[model samples]
Target: MPKLISQINQLQQLGLNAKEGVVYQPSRGFFKIVYQGLILPNLPAPLRYFNYISLVGQPRIPLCYNAHTITTSAIDTATVLVSNSQHSVGHLKTYSIRRQCQFDSEQYKFDKTDLIEWKIPKIHLQRLDLEMGCNLTIHISENISNNSALQWGVSDYWSTLCLCEGEVFYKGQKYQVEGLGRFRHARALHLPFLSLCFYTCQIINLNETTQLAFSQIRNQWNIILCSRLDIQEFGKPVESFTEDVNLHIHRVYPKVRTPNGKEMYLPREFSWQCKKNGKIIFELYAQSRGDYKFGLAAGYVGSFQYQLSWNEQCLQGEGGYCEYIDCRPLRWQEKNQDEKILDKLMLLQPCLYKK
Candidate 1:
């Protein structure tokens, strides 16, 4: 048990002002609420977002949405890659959009339909697809309290874990879902274009009242940039693992191509351990479930099963959500003039080339 701080309260203040995220310059921060393992009885698999939204790239010029003027020149972007399979490798439907965003103390809305609301101990998210005439809602039923606020390079991070219940309405049917949820809000003083080399995050619930969350990043030279592990238990203080921890990704799958042709590899298996004075405090090994959603701008989302040992207690076969983003440079090949001409020709005569 240690001193705890409410990170959400501080984000509330920052979200209200336009000066914090800098409307004109490049900003590197975001507010994200994710509900993973949302079991839907009506659907084949669960529902979740493939990639979280952030202020990563250069903001588009000031724009208007729904006849509403956006004072903040910065734009918010996110991609929702929903799938019917729970594994990491599969066909995915991407809902990637850039829209004018509005943020206040209570709600953060992108465009007119997608919104992340803060109700305090009960977070509500609403995503409406106007074209498809579908709606989604996820309600988190716990308080968002963090063990600590961490700093790495020029970025500051605040994360919390909780339980969630969700529902989806599509094609005149209602689907109910529930699972573990997480809230993360991060801020970077300057643009983070070159701040990170690669990032990995995994979250799993060991039991009804206990959960394990791990995040690690490396620099361009394959050095540990920053890493953290959070052990959250109900009715107790959150614990952190930062020092003297040996975290490693034991194996990685071959490079896979996204639907859009971006190529990146993913972890097949990974393990980590925390040692103090030749005694093991915690250790975990996880293997991917082979289910995933790619085509998310050099990142992928999926599920994993893990075995963990903490304080002499052993747990196995626990499943969770995992995300890996490889920011390292990918091999780039310029298309020759003949290949470029062929691409244009195919576009002009798609029917002739239909297989």
Candidate 2:
């Protein structure tokens, strides 16, 4: 028993054993943090240092945001504004989110110039109560090229009282979508090779007063750059946690052919867990709910809706998870290697698939 305990200790030291308060950096840029049940005063900033990277033959892509704002009005309405500028080409894009009351619930409208447009209809279960949870439906349209558009739909049941659940659909393919909505953030990255991939994160929300956020970043050689988490409480500051996590894949779905007939394998189910001080404190088991394929560079990439079960603080709940995957080109050693790099990145984290 003592030998087993010692081995566990060694794994913890190697950043394999998950624990709250222990910061783990597997390589130069990957950072991971785990917070058991602690309520942090504030939330930490997301990937502020490594904001942009320049590749050998590609343009310098900006990974950091220059400014963002959130405003709440008296009529139970809110607005979010975010802007980012590309350093090399001086290209700038701005995103706007407007949320307002609609009937007994709310509606969130998202717009981005030359990129995307979507509307999320949210229905609260209880009248005048935001804690009971809400129902959401999302219909999105993204312009990929002058001749084509990408369309998808997602339905979500979000609750602070119990578990959350939903489904995602694209071209008649449906995937499960379930997860906690207590805390989430939008992340955007521009790769000279792959263009831009945006990540929408949703995790389990344990309680009313506590929330956590984090990100895992990687590079071209499939090296992890960062995996960081931030814990925050209502009306308080934020505390940061870091650690490495082991991802176990239980199943892989059959390959689906894209519009161009390129085959892509999507993982149907997987599990992830983290430990703190040698005891398991957090874990997630998930399966794909729906998926879609889109063109990128010379290849195509995929995204999915996930059904998630999360365990933390001796408490377990079902929730939603969304992820993106990079696939291969039709030919070998294709000129655009960014998609290959994205495919290799699935090994970095269980729930996260970005660099």
Candidate 3:
């Protein structure tokens, strides 16, 4: 833990950044506050040296959530921003938090003695009072498979940076579409992102009944998010630079990811699904992005998860191809590098983005 703090102290020297905060994001639904950005160990600043720490977490429920997270820096007496939802990572969920840190006598220590934690209460999406998105008249099935033999399709616009089509495995085979949406990763998380394979953050029913997969597709070039909610990605204009974001669900059908690996295809097709009285009038498809291929990077969940972590760290410029940090900081190298504060801070930013 002291090592984690030492590393964090080295990072605060920098002005802006983000990182993976916990050793592992709680798998069964839990929140972790990663201590990042600390002033130089021997600071000569006139006033209190302050920095921001972020918490990256997801909700365990199949519903939208209202989550609150409070973190006391490894260094005590720091006042923090407690404004983001630390829950419901899938839809209308929030990385939604921003806090101010002010240090006191015991600044380097976490308040766990008194237990500063994330309080999560499950909220069902069925309880959401608002409609999710532009309703599709498409009829889905109990099994969620295309009973009508609906080959996957995508709709794209040049103005929309998204390729309008992406693919993943469904029932042991790869399914292709003009554009399928699900949670991906940061811009660096492209094509070989996660060891060159597809990854998802969660899968749940909007009303807690129908099941679907949620993945994140980021507009790599712009760094804006193109989120995947309910199998299909919503074509929304989003600014990734902002502190707010939203994702919706597809409640009409059950989305599926095949086991094994059967391959799907794309046609030089232009099509669309229309309804006069809420029904498909004809098969609608647009010029799809050239067909592409993707699936498991190469392993089971456990092996893949670790690989992703190592990849994230590497991209973020941290050493140690593998390290699980939980409130515990890395040891200062004391190498001739001389321990720059910005370097230390950057190390933590890649762990978990604290909003």
TM-score of each: 0.62, 0.35, 0.16
lDDT of 2 by residue, 187-280 (tens): 1122123212222222434455555443343333333334445454534444444664444445566556643344544455655555567766
Q: How well is each residue in 1-355 modelled by candidate 3, as lDDT tens digits? A: 5544432333222111212111211211221222221110101111101111222221221110112221332211222211111111211212222233222322222232111222111100111112111101111111111111101211001111112122222223332323211211111000111111112222211121222332333211212232332322233322121112222211111212222232211122212222235543222112212211111121111000110111123211111011000110112111112344446667884567789
Number of clashing residue pairs, candidate 3: 67
- Over 66-185, each residue of candidate 1 has an lDDT whose tens digit, in order, gives 001122322333333333334333222222234455556666555665566665555565656522222334443343445233233233444555555655544445556554455555
Deviation from truth (RMSD, Å), model 1: 14.2
Rank the models by lDDT, top first: 1, 2, 3
Error of 3 at 229 (Å): 4.0
Candidate 1 lDDT trough over 10 residues, lowest sum = 60-69
Instruction: State the displacement of the C-alpha of residue 273, model 3, in Å, after optimal TM-score superposition.
Output: 31
CA shift of 65, model 2, Å: 18
Model 2 bad stretches (over 4 Å):
1-202, 212-214, 257-264, 277-279, 291-312, 327-355
Query: What is the Cα-based lDDT of residue 232 in candidate 3?
Result: 24
Error of 2 at 289 (Å): 3.1
Overall local distance difference test of candidate 1:
0.49
Cα lDDT, all candidates: 0.49, 0.28, 0.19
